[model samples]
Target chain A: MDSAILLVRVLDFVGTFVFALSGAALGVERRLDLFGVLVLAFVTAVVGGIVRDVLIGAIPPASVASWHNLALAVAAGLLVFWFARAVARLSQPVLVFDAVGLGVFAVAGTQKALDHGIDWPMAAVLGMLSGIGGGMVRDGLTAQVPTVLRSEIYAVAALAGGLVVVAGGALGLPPVPVALAGIGLCVFLRLMSLVRGWRLPVARPPEP
Target chain B: MDSAILLVRVLDFVGTFVFALSGAALGVERRLDLFGVLVLAFVTAVVGGIVRDVLIGAIPPASVASWHNLALAVAAGLLVFWFARAVARLSQPVLVFDAVGLGVFAVAGTQKALDHGIDWPMAAVLGMLSGIGGGMVRDGLTAQVPTVLRSEIYAVAALAGGLVVVAGGALGLPPVPVALAGIGLCVFLRLMSLVRGWRLPVARPPEP
Candidate 1:
C-alpha cells in the first residue's frame, strides 16, 4: 500500500478505538448489558462514516467495506465488558479518550470529504457531522439530548479544525503537516472548552 | 403549479400531517414536554424525505426546500398538544393514520427517485428508506430499538409497494393507477401486520 493509505489506516484505527471506548464507557455508566454495549460501540464508531459515504455516493462505505473497523469495535466492547469494574475505577480516562477520538475523527472526515472533491465549506460541515453524528445518535439512543445541539463547543471545535485543513490545502501545504496542525488545534480547543466550561450562550428564558 | 406538482403537494401535506400526529402521540406516551413533542413531530415528518433526497444528491432536500412541510408539522404539533387527552382517547385511529402516512410517503419517495432517473431496484430501496428512516430515528431518540428492525414487516411493506410501482412503470402503466395500486398495497400490508402481530423471525439465540 502507498504511504497515504498506510497513514489513513492508522488514523482510522485510532479513531475507531477511541470512539468504541467512549461508547462502551457510556454503556457501562448506564449499566447496559453486554449486547447493548456492543451495539452502542458499533453505532458510535461507524454510523457517521456510513452516513457520510452514502451521501457522497460511495456504496457500502468504509464501515461495511472493511472488516477491521468492526473488529476493532467488537474488541473494544469485549474488553470494556470484561474489565468494566477496573475501567470504572479510573474516572477521567474515558472523557480524555472521547475527546481524542473526536479530534481524530473530525480531521479524518474532513480529509475524506476533500478527497471526494467536495468543496471546502461543505467538507468542513461534513467533517463536523462525522465527528458529532455518532455521539449524537448514541446519546439519543440512551435517552439523552445530543451534546451537539446543546451549549457545548464540541461541533464548533470540529468546525475549527476542518477549516484549518481547508485553509492549509488552499495555501498548498503538505498533507501531513496540515492534518497534524488541524488535529492539534481541535484537541486544544476541546480541552480548553471543557476545562473552562466555555459554551455558546443560549437564548435567555423569558422574564417573569 | 402544474397538475402533477399540485398532486404531489397534496399527498406530501397529508403524509406530513399523519406523521406529525404519530410522532406527537409517541411524545405523549413518553410524557415529554411540549418542546420535545414538537421536535419529535418535526423530525418524524421530515427526516425520512430529507435522507432520501440527500442520498440522491439533492442538496438541502425537500424538508429545507419546502417551508410548507415545517409549517404543517408545527401546526400538527400544536394541535396534538392542545388535544392530547382527546387524541389519546382515539387509540386505533392514530395507527390508521400512521398507515396512511407510510403508504403515501413510500409511494412518493419511489416516484421521486424514478423522477430523478434512478434505476428500479435502487429506487425501491430508497422508497423503503424514506418510509422507515424517520421512525427509526424517532425510536432511537426515544431510547427504543427501532420497530422496523425488530417488529412487523414495516420496511418490507414499503419495498413491496415500491416494487409494484416499478413493475407498473416497466409495463408502461399510467402514473395515477400505478400510484394508487402501490399505495394501496403498502397500506394493506402495514395494517395487516399491525393487526395480526406479523413480524420477521429473529435470529435464534446462540445455544447455551
Candidate 2:
C-alpha cells in the first residue's frame, strides 16, 4: 500500500514537471513575460489536480498543500525561459513526455477519486478531465480553442487510461500493474494518433 | 445569522441569473446553436462560485450542490435564446445586472472565505477572483482575450467590494449593511467606468 502511494506520488511529480514544461513552452511561443510564463506553468501543472481535488472534497489540493509542485513548475518555466531555443529544439522529446504525463495523470486521478470513495463512473470522467484540464486552461488563456475539445485522440487516450484503472479496481486487480498498463496504453494511443494525423472533423466557419 | 445566510443565497441566485443572461446573449451574438448557448450560460453563471467554494473547502460547491443554480442559469439562457432581439435591446439593463452580479459575487466570496478562516489578504484576492472568474472562462471558451485581464476598473471594483466585506468582518460591523455597501460600491465603480470610458494604458504590440 505504501509502495503504491509512493508510485502515484512519483508519477504525479513527473506529470507536473512535463505539463509545466508544455505550458512554459507555450508561454515562450506566445512571448509572455517571465512572471506570466511561470504563472502559466504552475497553473497548467496543477489545475487538473486542483479541480479533481475540489470535486472530491480534498481541501487544500495536494499541489497547494506542498511546495514541491510550485518548485517543479518554477524550475520548468525557468528552464524554458533561459534556454528557449534549446527547449524549442527538443519538441520531439517534449511531445513524448507530455503524452506520458497525460497517461499518468489520467490513471492517478482515477485512483485518487476511487480512494476518496467516488463511484467509478464519475471517477473515470474526472480522470479524463484531470488529464485534459490543464491543457484546456492553457489554450484558453492563450485564446486558442482547446485542442482537447477538438482533437479526436487526445481525450480518447485519457479516457482509455481511466477505464483501465476503473476496470482493474472492479476486477480486484493489483494497483501497480493496472496503473502501468493504463499509462502504457494511453501513451501508445496518443503517440500513434499523432503519427497517423488522427483528428476529429472540424466544423466549417460561418461564411464571413 | 440565518438572515445573513439567506441574503447571500438570494444575492447569489440573482448574480447567477444575470451572468447567465450575459453569457447567453454573447452566444446568441456569436451565432452559436441553442445547446452551445445554454452551456455557455450555465458555465458563466456558476464557475466563479465554484472556484470560491473549492478554495474555501466548500465541498460539492454551492453551485454544483444546489439545483437552483442550474435552474436559474437555464431559465436565463432560454429567455435570451427565445428573445434574442429583445434581449439585445435591453443591453443597458443587462450591463447593470452584470455589474450587480460581479459585486455580489465578490462580497459573498469574501464573506465565505472569511467564514472558512482564510486571512484577509487572501480573502480579498479570492473575492476578486470569484467575481471575475466566470467572465474570464466565458470569454476564453469563446476564443477571446478575457476582459478582466485587460480592464483596470473591473477587477478593482470587485476587490473593493471584497475589501468592504473584510473590513466589516474585522470591525465587527453588521453583515447585511456591509454587504449592501460592498455591492453598491462595486456596481457604482463598474458603471461609472463604463460611462466615462475609463481605461488603463495598453502595451504596444510588437510589429508583425
Candidate 3:
C-alpha cells in the first residue's frame, strides 16, 4: 500500500513538472518577464486541480495544502526561463509534455472525484475538465484561442480516458489497472492528435 | 419588493453589458478574429459569476440558464469587432465601463451570497472575487500579467464595497440602501485610483 502511494506521488510530480514546462514555454514565447513565467507555471501546474477540488467542496484545495506542487512549478519555471534558447531549439516539446500531463491529470482527477461520491458521468466530466482546464487557461492568457476549442481533440482525449476509468470501475477492475489503462489511452489519443494535426471543423459564418 | 426585484434585474443587465464591453475591447486590442472576440466576451461577462454560483452549489449558474447574458456578450463582441477603429478612438471607454462593471458585480455578488446564507467574511471574499475574476482571466489570456494583481486598488475597491454590505446587513439595514452605499464606495475608490495612478508597492526581487 505504501509503495502504491509512493508511485502515485511520483507520477503526480512528473505531471506537475510537464504542465509547468508547457506554461513556462508559452510565457517565454511571448517574452513575458520572470514574474509572468512563474505565474503561468503556477496556473498551469495546479489551477485545474484547484478547480476540481473547489467544485467537489474540497476547501483550500490540494495545491494550497501540499507544497510539492508549488515547488515543482517554481523549479520548472526557473529552468525554462534560464534555458529558453536551448529549450526553444527542441521543437514541439510542449506538445509532448502537454499530452503526458493531460493523461496523468485525467486519471488522477477521475479517481479523486469518485472518492468524493460523485456519479460516474459527472466524475468523468470533471476529470476531463481537470485534465485540460489549465492548458485552456494558459492559451487564453497568451492571447491565443484555447487549444481545446480548436481542432486539437484535447478535451476528447481526456473524455476518452475518463470513460475508460468509469467503465473499469463499474466492472470491478482493480484501481491500479484501471488507472493505467485510462492514462495509456489518454496519452495515446493526445499524441496521435498532435502527430496527425487532428482538428474539428469550424462552423461556417452565416451568409449575408 | 417587486420594485426591488426589478431594480436588481436592471442593474444586472447593465453590469453584464459593461463587462461584455470590457471583454470585447480587449479582443479588439488583441486583433482577435470574430470567433475569438465572441468567446472572450462570453467568458469575461459571465465566468466570475458562474464560478461564484458553482462554488455555492448553484448548479448550471445564471449564465448557463439564461440566454440574455449570452446575447449581450455576442452583441458587444460583434460591435467591437466591426468598429474596432472607432472604438479605439474613444479614449479609455473600456476602463470606465470596466470600473462600473466591477462595482455592480461586487454589490450583486455580496447580496446573492448573503441570500444563500453565506457568512459576511466569506460573502465579501466571494463578492470581490466575482468583481475581479473575469478581468483577471481576460488579462491572463491576453499574455499580460493580471491587472488585478498589479492594480491592487481594483480588488481593494471591491473589498471595500463588500465590507460595507456586510456591515449594513449586520446592523439590520435595508438591502437597497446597503447596496447603494456599497456600490457608491466601489465607484469612488476605483475612479480615484484611476485618476491618481494609485498602486500597491510590489515586493522587490530577492538578491541572489
Candidate 4:
C-alpha cells in the first residue's frame, strides 16, 4: 500500500515536470519573455490540480501551499527556457510523458473526488476535467483551440480512466489495483489515438 | 436594505449581458462557428463569479447552479450571433456596460469573500479577480493576450474598488454605502482611462 502511494507520488512529480516543459515550449514558440514562460509552465503543471482541488472544497489547494510542487514546476520551466532548442527536438518523448501525466492525474483526481464524498458520475467528470484543464488553459493563454476540443482521444481517455476507477470502487476493489488499472487504460488509449491520428469532427454549419 | 440588494442584482444582470455580448462579438470577429460564439459568451459572462465562488469554498458555484445566469449568457450570445453587424455599431454602449459590470463585481466579490471569513487583503485580491477573471478567460479562449495584462485601467480599477470595500468593512461602515462608494471608484476609473487612452507600458527586455 505504501509502495503504491509512493509510486503514484513519483509519477505525479514526473508528470508535472513534463507538463511544465510542454507549457514552456509553447511560451518559447510564442516568443514570450522569461516571466511569461515561467507563468505558462506553472499554470500548465499545477492549475488542473488546483481546479480539481477547489471544486472538491479543498481549501488552500496543494498547488498553492506545497513548495515541492511549485519548485518542480518552476525548475521544469527554467530547464526548458535554458535549453529550448534542444528540448523542441524531443517532442516525441514529451507526448509520451504527457500521456503518463494524464493517466496519473485522472486516477488521482477520481480518487480525491470519491474521498470527498462526490458521487461516481460527478467524480468521473471531475477526473477528466483534472486531466485536461491545464492543457486547455495553456492553449487558451496562447490563443489556440484546445487540443481536447479538437481531438477526441485525450478527454475520452481520461473519462474512460475515471469510469474504471468508479466502477472498481463500486465493486469493492482495493485502491491500489483500481488506480493501476485506471492509469493503464488512460495511457493506452491516449497513445493509441496519437498513433492512429484519431480526432473528433469539428462542428459544421447546416447546409443552407 | 432589500432595495440595495435588488439594485445590485439588476446591475449584475445588465453587466452579464454586456460581457456576453462582447465575447460573442469577439467570436464573430474571429470567424468562429456558432458553438464557439456561445461558449465564449457563456465563459465571459459567468466565469469571474464562478472563480470567486470556488475560491471562497462555495460549493456548486451559483453561476453554474443558477438557471437565470446561464440563460442570460446564452440569450445574449444568440442575440449577438444573429445581429453581428448591428451589435458592432454599439461599441460605445458595450464599454459603458463593461465598466458597470466591473464595478458591481468588484464590490460584490469583496463582500462575498469577507462573508466567507477570508481576511481583508485576500478578500480585496479576490474581489479584483472576480471583476476580471471572466474577461481574462474569454481573451485566453480566443488566443489573445489578456487585456488585464496590457491595459492599465481595468484591473487597477477593480483593485481600487476592492481596496475601498476592504477599508470600509474594516472601519465598521454599513454595507450599502460602502458598496456604493467602491462601485463609484471602479466605474470612474474605468471610464476615465477609456476617455484618456491610458495604458500601462509593456515590459521591455533589459539591455545586456
C-alpha DockQ of every model: 0.06, 0.12, 0.06, 0.12
In angstroms, give how far residue B90 of model 2 lies from its true place.
Answer: 11
- Candidate 2 runs further than 4 Å off: A31-43, A54-89, A92-97, A117-126, A140-145, A149-153, A159-185, A195-208, B2-47, B54-104, B117-129, B137-145, B148-208
Ranking by lDDT: 2, 3, 4, 1
The residue-by-residue lDDT of candidate 4 on A107-196, one tens digit each, is 877777777777676677677778878888888788778866443478778888989989988898887888889999998988887988
- Candidate 4 lDDT for residue B166: 90
Candidate 1 local accuracy as lDDT?
A: 0.77
> Per-residue lDDT of B84-203 in model 4, one digit per residue for the tens?
777666656446656777888888888778878999989989989988888888777766888787756899999999899899878988877888899999989888888887666777
For TM-score, candidate 1 versus 2, the one ahead is 2
| Model 4 TM-score on a 0 to 1 scale | 0.58
The residue-by-residue lDDT of candidate 2 on B144-189, one tens digit each, is 7775644446877888899999898889999999999999999888
lDDT of 1 by residue, B1-208 (tens): 6544555556677888898888877776666656557667877888888888987777545565345677789799778777777777775644666677788888778877887889889998998888888777777677778878766878888898888878987898777778788889998998889888777778888999
Q: TM-scores of the models, in the given order?
A: 0.59, 0.62, 0.57, 0.58
Measured on C-alpha atoms, candidate 2 has an lDDT of: 0.82
| Ranking 1 against 2 by lDDT, winner | 2
Better of 2 and 4 by TM-score: 2
Q: Rank by TM-score, descending? A: 2, 1, 4, 3
**Residue B124 of model 3, lDDT score:** 92
Q: Provide chain B TM-scores across all predictions.
A: 0.91, 0.91, 0.90, 0.85
Listed per model, the TM-scores of chain A against the true chain A are 0.93, 0.90, 0.90, 0.87
